[model samples]
Target: MTDSTKYLQALEEFILLGKSAPGAAAVANIQKCISSPNCFVFAELLELPNVQALVNDAEHKKWVEALKLFAYGSYMDYKQQKSAASDSLPDLTDLQLTKLKQLSLITIASTEPHRLTYPSLQSLLDIPTTRLLEDLIISAVYASLLDAKLDTANQRVEVSSTAGRDVAPGDISNMIAALEGWSASCSSVLTEIEAQIASIQASAVAQRKEQLAYEKLVEEKRKTAEKDGSKGKRVMDHSDNTGFGLGEDEMDLDDGPFDDQGGARKSRKGGNKMFSRKR
Candidate 1:
């Protein structure tokens, strides 16, 4: 049967029990707890004003315990209570039984890790056989209470995920505190990463500047060397031209009639040339 239908039926049973006010209040509280995130019906049921009001009343005490068991208590809890006092325990209908099993599965998921063995589940569910336990788990999976894998070979159920339930009192505060801590940790990590990146970038910039300076220095040295080479070549050329001019002048003075005696030598040479022409 659908959960809503079962709930309505339970509500009607409560009304028939002559405790409509508290019964409806309890059921409403259960519904609210089931709908809220991370909330459990067990403690929430106990905390209900109506349920609490029934606690001291000898006549309605059974109904309060019944609501608690119906909303959250497991078959084991029921069994234990029945062992203690059978007459005090409320009889569970088939729908309520199914709901109890489903809620028990949710509790298991919340309290335990991913993988659960068949024997362990049997202990938790108080089921008679492995088949019944597997059937219950399968039903829960089909109802979308759990995302799981049934390993028949290994005799275990691997729960991959589960939905969140209503939050209990103080649960929100605890969650907020945990989230704040996580946020602080993330902020610290990000700060460290940013600092490291900044350091690397600065180092890279410094290295690039150093490389550019070195290149500029080499270029300047190259230009200076070229300038010095050109100057040396010009000086050597001038020296070679001066040596050649001096040698040519000495050769002309020694071979020709022109001596070191200034214009007299030049005039004597001209007269000799004229006499030779007349002869």
Candidate 2:
């Protein structure tokens, strides 16, 4: 068989295997089909690797099948190499194309095509988004089969090569105009927001300064009160000392604790003589 035919066959078989309830032989077949570089591909295909033995088990068989599927597809497409651009590129066979067209028609009938709709046709295929992106990137690739067809048709219609060779000039102009208009509005909004932010920052700074000033005033008041309190204590201490400084007041002769200094002297002499006689 031609390489193309073999690739087409492998693609269909891979899709079939992808949907099956996984077993060792089935998983191994899938691995052989896909040629997985890591266990993750095996894990994903089988849905779980718990059944696969840790060291070397029959689960490796699943990976073998997966590898075969992967290899067959990869060998056919140069564009599918070393990239996550699966959605961008599609390896659709004639039968697959027919099915896809039918699916697309159904989608259009049920949903608006030009209303910025997401692709529902892919969901029907149960295509992973990773693969979908790959296909889209491949589809959008410069001068792929689809674009070549368009370019060929354009060349047939237009005598001049320059005519419609690039994006339509008017379309680009309109897009630029829209961008400029949006940019002007965005710039104004940004300016207003910046002004508001600046005002808020200034107000916060002023409030902080006012708070600091108030704190300072309160601190000064506290210090002054403390100083005044200390001074009052000092004055009270001086007054107490002065009151106790003088000796006990002498008894007044008139009050008769002693009649006079002479009487006090005679009493002392009598006491001394009495003490001597006793000795």
Best by lDDT: 1
lDDT per residue for candidate 1 within 1-279, as digits (tens), equals 754454445444333433344755554544443343232234434554676787676765776676566455556687789889986865666666666777778767777754278888887777789888888888777766788888999988888876444454556798899999999999999999999999999999999999999999999999999999988873333245346423323322234454454332434223433112221
lDDT of 2 at 72: 23
Model 1: lDDT equals 0.64
Give TM-scores for every candidate, taking all chains together and pairing residue i with residue i: 0.58, 0.32
lDDT of 2 by residue, 1-279 (tens): 533344345445445565653455454444343332111112233333432331154434434322322322222222333244543332434433332332232223223433212234244334455445235323422211122112222222111111011122255787799899999999999999999999999999999999999999999999999999988873223234456433333222334323444333224223322112221
| Alpha carbon lDDT of each predicted model | 0.64, 0.39
Off by over 4 Å in 1: 1-53, 65-89, 170-177, 218-279
